[model samples]
Target: MVKKGRPDKRSKTRSQAAGGGGGALPSGELIGPFDRTLLYLAVFLTGAAIMMIEVLGTRILGPFYGVGLFVWSSLISVTLIALALGYYLGGIAADRAKRFQLSHGIALAALATALIPVFKTPVLLQTNALGVRAGAFTSALLLFSVPLTLLAMVGPRVIKLCTSRLESVGRSAGSVYAFSTVGSVLGTLVLGFFLLPMMGTRTILYGVSVGLLVLAAVLALYERARRNTLGLLVLPFVSLAIAGLLFFLGGDRLPSTPGFTTVYEAQSIYGRVRVVDESERQIRWLLSDSSTIGAIDLRTGEPEFPYLYILEALPRFHPRGRSALLIGLGAGQLPKLLGRYGIETDSIEIDPEVARAAKDYFGFNHPGRLILGDARYEVRRLRKKYDFIIHDCFSRGVVPAHLLSVEMLQDLRSLLNDGGILALNFYGYAEGPQALPAAAVAKTIEAVFPFHRVFVSSLQTELTDHVFFASTEPVEFKADKVDIAPSPLGKLMLDNLFRYEHKISSDQGFVITDDFNPLDSMQVRKAEIYRHQVLSDISADLLAR
Candidate 1:
């Protein structure tokens, strides 16, 4: 068997053929230069398509499945596994089929690439219906994986087929891999930055579909100008029509219950941004990077700060309200709430797409100054000081490790006022009736600021991960007129959602540090409770019918 990096003899033959070392093509039986060139082009396109499919597949499934470190790790693992299998199979198949063999393999992958978008939704449905959460990811691999793996087979098969002069195959194989890699790099950058947002999901998918189908048709026609060639030509036309029909008349997805509606949905480089507005109320829920950041009730038009109460209490508890810094500006809730009380605010939210989104959909008015970059780096650069430095950076399912680093916390303290406060939100067993590693973060927070106080934002009903607030000053730990609380009339104005209690009071053993943040450990422990919370919080019953 040929090793992965080192070229086998067939590749050497192909290189010699390309270099004009082994004379010209010997008429009809020998492979023509155009044929070889076309074959290489086919290989390149298929390789590029394989990569883009992985990206697109993740985007398509991510809104439902999530795109956290867990999801990414799963997708990447499955892709490498598929590639390994492809490498193995391609070698075996090349050895067996010498005739229409290599040509057939690459052409088939092109055809399979065309088929991806059409089957995407149905596969999603099948996975959903299976209701197999344990293998939720493995199930994803089971479905779209076959086509993707098949697509990976194109390179080796093409290399094996095109070589007649054994000596040149080495350079030929390298050239093939190079073209394929270049195609992949180009595909990733273009699709991620330009295609997904500007063109729309349907356009991007169908565009790839059309390209792949055209390549397949080219191969079929190049093989023989028969009815099948004509038939292959018609496939893209039919695909276009079907894809168009799906795009234009795509029916709404009925929710499990009624009143919940997806007011807006878009793919962003960070993840999927979904703005779900409950019809019964003016509450707009923002899902950035797959986690719920804030829900603003449009009727009240005031940001409900469950955490605001906690943040406001800090100044009273700590008294130094000179400067304030915030990270993870979702809906600009924390910063917005701070601004309302006449406190100075500097906010950083990573995604510019998200920053714009916060304005258009999430009701997050642009802060006086909004910085777009990783919070860790931003904090290090800003030599300014704050009375209350808030580290509220939380993304769905996982938190950014940098934000929790001891180094970052220390830097944040450097800019902190002498009697300053640092409040960090951690979600523990919020669902109900479970053990959580929520204490780990508290321990970590304590490690950084040993003198700070921690409190739960909500009613403190269970062992849930809640807000662990740290302050240089000793907190009074009382909720007297918390800064963002509702008045009697304002409280009356809120939907029941605004009133649900948040869990904040618990001392888990470990804490998130520059070194040890066992989020997955916390997740596994709190899975059942978390699931119940999701079932209750985002229950199908609350969504659009």
Candidate 2:
């Protein structure tokens, strides 16, 4: 059971008389000085690490399964449980020792922290079910339980060590809490806003591992080098090697034919963006989830070309691409394609680094009106109505909370012209050759649009992402409506997409929510859980093949 606060002697005595406080802690003087410092550092580091583990965890899990709610919840819940266990166990460990030794405990705890970078991928890769159920989530909780639980002990255990008298106990606790919280504030600002996006995930993991290992070594300074010393040296190198291998070996690095010139490959703020040479048909901008949002074709590269699906689909449905808006600008592919087609696309993309990568590697330059901000805010501010709009922005690792909310969709609706078409893409779960999530999304779209039809993108299997296109008027795929010479590049892409044989399931459903439009909130039967399992099986199957 989770318990809190140090009770006064009088209260303890009264409770004992009432047969409820027989094991009450005896009042002691404030804890020692060295002990307090150790306690403070431990808690401070613990808080920072917790934030790192929680935030970075999402990024680590994202590539396999888009950062959906189920993944986020799994990460959150596991971290919480780790903290809870750490708190309870730390107190017991401290009380058993009578007087706390900062060095040994701190060293032990830091060593545990350092181990994270080492075992992270292996633990994940080796996890049974590859995570078909809550097993993955549960195991993750257990893996980190050792260090986090120990870290949790700092507050209460330190109070026990530092409190010299009953009167000063409360004051001492507050001081520690304040300092620790301050550490948390700095941790969030640095890691979330600055360090993570810039440094990238694997590098950051290595840095954290080094800091922790160093902390442990510093604690053991006075004594002769322990056997663990060699371990400290070797482990960091091992971590470096593993991270390096994973980085280089990552993604679909293999060739994707001749004309599709893939320009840049970097893990950036918006997952991974690849600018492709569609043999000058357009620069196809691809995001991590393999979604293309923007393209630029033609030698002039001015945002004004009249072309195929986008051209015909928009105007034919009582809407058109005069003031076209796109949420994701991968390699400026869609923008390039649209600009060549004369659409005058307005793009709102979150990651500037991705834009830079696009420029450097994928021919991503400013396409028409560029809005470098969150799409939701940009859409809210825009006064002109859009004939065509694409909701390509997703939760950084999953569907962003703001984007999924009814308010945001309503915002998008307001910006569209009468009978305008809006396309939304999401990665969700489906079963039995039927795209359930597509059906659910269709239901949500129907609620917003007056008339709509759901189109399922061909995934290799039942459990794959589905795209939905909804409009104020009905939509049908018309080949003749498309203008321009069908570029070899677009044709190649179309060919690959053609292999995907997914049809939208009419019977599948979802609870339409105005408040919490959470995808992947289901823990046990989570999207990620099923996906990882499938991925592992695929990996094994491919290896055997």
Candidate 3:
């Protein structure tokens, strides 16, 4: 029987632990109220770190695997799976005798996160070599699964530590989740709005690592002081030192093939921006998300991309243009031509850095208004109608779905004067299974404008740039005069342009509307085909050396 005055050993220990207010934990060492507060703070940060990493992981994976629908779906799935596994395992671990030791897991997570930048390039390269869907899945699984799991474990463990009795369990879990969710919201806002746009990926990753390690240090110091065990406090410092070593040893290298020199690179809000100089060809390439935007001949300062030259036939179709609007600015090649012809040109470029890179490196000082923002919104706000409008916008060969919808086509048509011309540069095959994208685009355009014509840059090429021309009145091609005194190469390009032009049937496919647009889904197979071709080309280039 138990006595009222003196209890048994288990009962006495329980009383000492529960009634030991602001003293040692049940594990036989001190972790006071202050320490508990710090632990909660650690929980808050852990939540934030997980979300920040999830958001940034897409940017990290985009250069190689693309930010396509499949790739994004894989990333989101991987993150959710990791978090679920963490929750289950953390709950089991929390039931153990030792209970949750905040510093131990957090310190390890800090080190793991720091190592991401170190292994990221090689890991992604290896996975992306596997091809599109598999590569996107494997890359997300390999790079993020481990760190996200460990980071997620902190939440359940924090809930376990903060609660002392069955009565307080509800309150404890609720408070921890509330704090964590709020932290996640703040982290998303801060990272998306401020950090990502201004910072490099490696810089952001390392910063997060340092932040986690510092929090671990605080917990380590408090644990050591309370337990009077100084030996274990060195763990946080060691993790930090190792992180520093990884960063110094393995810095982010530019994603490029051999013989290509990286002239300029940056992490922009939209995607990765890279300017690569092809030494052999004496040309420079503007790459966004690892796809060539436009290339310029370094010697002549002329656009070297065949597609842009095909578009040079724009003014010939509609000669009444004293004013023109260009929807996309890639190295400002088209607008420069328009400006040179003394047409009051207004160009729209979404990315500010792309425009800046154009001016600084590509010599794109076209005499026109360079309006900065999304073309969809900017077009709606325009007060004046244009005689010529060029739609050459593409993100890695996929036109943004919003811009291609029937409503958008109608809106663009409304912005044009009577007999005005609209020229669009689209990349896809004009026949076979790959013809669907071009066919859909044609159908949508034909619905808006009564007269339209499609011209393929090359009939022999499987995937070539198809320039679509539409006019209020019937459109006809009239070659620039012989006495115009244009460059010999420019004259050759214009002469050959008519030869490469081909017709596309508008009755072949359904129209793309805003509500039922499936362009991204339709382009998946084409994207995969392109992805494989790129890998094959890279391999061939490497083998030829």
Candidate closest to the true structure, highest TM-score: 3
Tens digits of per-residue lDDT for model 1 on 343-381? Answer: 777888887766776788756663456889888778777
Every model: Cα RMSD to truth: 7.1, 9.2, 3.8
Model 1 is weakest, by summed lDDT over 10 consecutive residues, at 19-28
**What tens digits encode model 3's per-residue C-alpha lDDT throughout 1-545?**
87788758886566444332222244433345886787778878988998888888877777676677877898899999999998887776665524235666677888888877777767776766577788878888888888888888777777766766545668878988888888888888889899988988888888888888888888778767766777556788899888888778767665456767777888787887778787778888786764567778899888876777666666777765668888888887887766644567788999887888888888887666899999999989888898888898875444688898889888889989988988888888778977888898888888888898877766676887888899879988754531233454556778777787777775687899989898888887778776665444333222111
lDDT of 2 at 192: 77
Instruction: Determine which window of 10 residues in candidate 3 has minimal summed lDDT.
Output: 536-545
Native-vs-model 3 lDDT? 0.76
> Which pairs of residues collide in candidate 3?
24-30
Give TM per candidate: 0.78, 0.68, 0.90
lDDT of 2 by residue, 462-540 (tens): 4444545677767655546556443454444344543543455456656346565545443224344455443432332
lDDT of each: 0.60, 0.54, 0.76
Instruction: Return the TM-score for candidate 2, rounded to 2 decimals.
Output: 0.68
